[model samples]
Target: MKRYLQYGFTTFADHYGSSEILYGQFRKGLLASAMPTTPRPIGATKWCVFRSPPTPYSRKYVEEAVRERMSRTLSDGIDILQFHWQDYDDPRYMDVIQHLLDIKRDGKLRIDELGLVNFDSRRVDEICRTFGSGALVTNQVQFSLVDTRPLYGMASVCAKHQIKLVTYGTLCGGFLADKWLNKPQPDPYFDSLTPSQRKYLDVILGAWGGWELFQTLLSVLRAIGDRHNGLSISNVAVRWVLDHQFVAAVIVGARLGVAEHKDDNAHVFGLRLSQQDRVDVASVLADRTDKI
Candidate 1:
């Protein structure tokens, strides 16, 4: 997987146990807003970064932050720099984004693309209108079959602005995969689930229907996988997201040096869903997206 292909090397939004992975909840103040960006590990393949800068927003601060991130990349410059900002009430995030875009325009550090991380539909629209079209390239957000919030309204905003969605959680932290199919819901109070699992379980119960509905969804995905040359549920899920025209890419999470699904992940491109496949998945997803 390392030796070939056009895919960019991606990383997790946060270390699995960290609360920052709860990207959508910052508006409610559910998690810390501005933790230090996770350092890119030595020898890591880095294409994009997820960073949230705390205010007082200034050009010096933004430049220094962008420089620090670029210095960590293996090349002289980074391919994609994705910005995350909490405190939507502040309104100075526009200044910060402007500064980053200025740096990219300067071309000294070679920031090939600029994007937003976890900004919602309304914010995306506002930013795009403020910056005018084509100023930024993408927005990274959580979009899995189990959590269709992005599809609810995010997709339309991206289409209108000509921005692509670089999505994470397409696997729902791996719950949407086959290993969890037919499995009973784990008790969060017990050790049956990791912190990430516990986090996504909240999404599963809230944004999706409850456990039984999730199981039914999983069964549908498994059957869909079978229809496409016995592809795994993971492949089926990735395929579903890629099938969306507004989705520029899907960011699958993995722990570096521990495990990687490069081979299985690549198979997603080989499978294509039929019209019936979409209906079956949609049947289980019926009315669940209303909460999102």
Candidate 2:
């Protein structure tokens, strides 16, 4: 793993509200530990869009932000810059994106590609139209078996623009795993769920047709998993998302040394769902109308 780190394939996303200095130090320490004899990969780091609000509209501010980002992670080799924004109505995001493009054009930064995070379908189409199809490469969004809203509009725009969808939440905050399957509905007060659990639980209850429907979905996934060499529910869930044509990749959250699914996750690559499996899963999801 350390040797792999030296090859520069390790990618890290900037956390909101965190200082760049701290992030740089952490990245540097990891890279320094890697063996120098290893062959270097094409790029090392992927900087996400900075969310500082004071000057979102200012080109100068945007440039400075990019400069700061490059200064911090350039040593690690940044491959792509992914942007995140809250309000789609704000025209300033376009300005910021244009400025980043201009910076890339100027050869001031070594960024290889640019993309968006959590931008809606409409906004993604607008950005692609304004900037041209190749300007952006992907739109990262919360996509999963339960939240298939992206299938409706985002998929078409992405297909048209040739932008792939990098999906997160495919496991629904670990709720889709076998540990929760057939288990009694958790009491929010008595059960100690992680922050992700609380967040996605709300989505499950409010938008995903509540506990009963979720159980049905889980049962369907379990049956599919059992047929495919007893793959875990999470593996089946992720495999289902990967089966989609629009999905470029799935971002599975890790807790480092605390808990790891390295082996179970590896099963996803080997498992293949049959057409009957797809039909069974789709049959369960077809009844739901809520969009996440």
Candidate 3:
């Protein structure tokens, strides 16, 4: 089995844009949002994430942030800079690209190290045509056994252009483990009240055809885990994502110093889910994505 430190290069998202609200959440301070603009002097791959466009601010506000952040890249000689692009149709999309290119052209950002968040196959070709070859490195999205939307088509688009996938939501907010097996449904208000927490359970129960079927799928995963020498349900689920065609990395969130399942997460590096494993697990899932 691969060691946890072997996958230690996964990107960490510090508090949103270095805000005090986020910084206060941690006892030990994390890397700043502008850290992406600074490369590791010893050749380590550096990553940083921003929560959203600094809003309630004007275009000048946005431009100043970009310029200020990008300037650090020039001073520090960084290569790749990462950010999210939620809406491709947004007019600001063009401006964002132009700023990155300007940074690259001026030797602040490396041309080969641009990445965007939340894009899937439908947008891959458009991204390529707009950014050109080797301009982008990753198309980060949600991909897991419980969420295989990428497998339906996104994999092919990414594979064609050599774009790597960075996936998240692999553990489904701790629901993909033994703790939930045969458990009573969580209260929508008192148990799973957070919007995301509720929505994912809905996706799982709905996809598996109902809460009853989801339990069955969990049982199947448990059996598979036992057969594989006490492999974890979390491992099986994340390994399934890695087994997909174009995934490069999976982001498993860490709550600092609370190293609970970091060991199981490392198992993903070496485990391979068998064909029967895939069929058994995917069988109960609904392809209800057509509504969108």
TM-scores for candidates 1 onward, in order: 0.81, 0.86, 0.73
* Per-residue lDDT of model 2, residues 1-292, tens digit only: 3333343325444444443454566556656768576543322223444444664467687666666666765353356678887765566788888987987788766567888888998899999999999999988888999889898999899899999988888898899999998888887777999888888988888888889889999999988888988899999999999998989878787665666577788788788899999999889887775766
The TM-score between candidate 3 and the true structure equals 0.73
Candidate 3: regions farther than 4 A off: 1-10, 14-80, 109-112, 192-195, 286-292
Candidate 1 vs candidate 2, TM-score winner: 2
For 1-292, candidate 3 gives per-residue lDDT tens digits of 0123334433343223443223232212223433543332211122332334555435454445554443433323333455565655554655665566666677643444666677657666776777775667777777766677787777777877788887878777777778888888787678745565587788765653556666777788888887788888778877777876688777776554564476677666677778888787766554333221
Candidate 1's residue-wise lDDT over 46-128, tens digit each? Answer: 22324444547677877776665544432455566777777787777788888888888988667777888889899999999
Q: Whose TM-score is higher: candidate 1's or candidate 3's?
A: 1
Clashes of each: 0, 0, 0
> After superposition, which runs of candidate 2 have C-alpha atoms over 4 Å from their true positions?
1-11, 14-56, 74-77, 289-291
* Model 2 per-residue lDDT at 17: 46
Candidate achieving the largest TM-score: 2
